[model samples]
Target: MTEDAATIPIRPAELAAFLAARMCHDFISPASAIVSGLDLLEDPTAQDMREDAMGLIAASARKLADLLAFSRVAFGASASAETFDARELEKLARGVFGHMRAELDWQVEPAGVNKPAARTLLNLAQMAGAALPTGGSARVRAVEEAASIAIAVEATGPRARLRPEVLAGLRGEGPGEGLHGHWVQARYVNLFVGDAGGRVFADVAEERVTLAATIPA
Candidate 1:
């Protein structure tokens, strides 16, 4: 992450770097949990522990599957007609947040977004999901506006706060010293907004946080 006051577009190399980091970060936890479960299964004297290990493996595998599906659509590149089905995006978000403490309340008018804007919209929602670390609600909204589409995520819960570095990264000022691959989502949100000739903002209250980005119609 850079120290600039203005956000900049991420080049291919940078995007690749971020993707690599995030894939590892998102996949590692559940993957490790699965391995631990396997190890428990290997203990010859732990016959009675089979049921618990099986449950752990099943849950972790499901979480990994959910995350992978969401990431595939959110980060992959493809084209279909001229718009993205909002319902599909909503489903992906639900799948992702369902495995966590957050529940997504989604509202999308017109039922689709211009294909180019979908990624940013989804990324903002994902950011909102990550902000609610203490079991809260994250609302994702996409609405048609004056010559533009506005996407926002409003999250409320106890001890809700955007990590300072992540906030900075989303603001386009880079993550200061912590700019790494895991922060690419925030970076991409800002980058997409700039590419769409729009602005991004975030607000934090005592127990709430909202992150938003816009794209032109």
Candidate 2:
């Protein structure tokens, strides 16, 4: 796809707002669950349900923690670490997938990768998971090819589908009449991959969605 061809521009401020909203959306559910569990603990009448409340608190805490760790590397600067270990990346990917309906299958060839590649892998993997709402498999693969690192994620299962806004974002275009949360992620991926002098691609078919990118190594 041509970069920014026939694309509506999203200002920096708008992009930041959309990203912040997206992250907050992901975090709120677990956070709210934790709060609700605390409320139940303080209620004397609810003492009999303490066990259920505790379970909710524990699970919500874990989910929140997992999302936080994943978000750091996937979206934040991650404390100036330029390269990331594949195993650690896999752990992060699996952590997020643990709360999802889909399963993660990571098969990365490289031992480590730079920040852009790391973000690409994590984002694409999560996107793949999102594509399979009913439950499916998201297979992530990365390999060193010549002077570039190739990353691909194939999401396949019953009812798997790609959103139109995601396709637009992957093509470096703004989301038109679509949900900004989903759109911003693909747009962010497109921007970073392009900044690294690479290209991004996406394809959607019956029960399958594929996302791929190539970044300079």
Q: Predicted candidate 1: what Cα RMSD to the true structure?
A: 2.9
Give the winner by lDDT: 2
Q: Which has the greatest TM-score?
A: 2
After the best TM-score superposition of candidate 1, give how far the Cα of residue 106 lies from its true spot, in angstroms: 1.1
lDDT of 1 by residue, 1-217 (tens): 5545435555779777877788789899999999999999999988799999999999999999988887776776343546778888888888888787877888877577885577776777778878888778888787889989887789899878788777877777656666565366777667667876888889999889998777887
lDDT of each: 0.79, 0.94
What lDDT does candidate 2 reach at residue 190? 91
Task: Give the alpha carbon lDDT tens digit for every residue of 24-115 in model 2.
Answer: 99999999999999999999999999999999999999999999999999999598899999999999999999999999999999999999
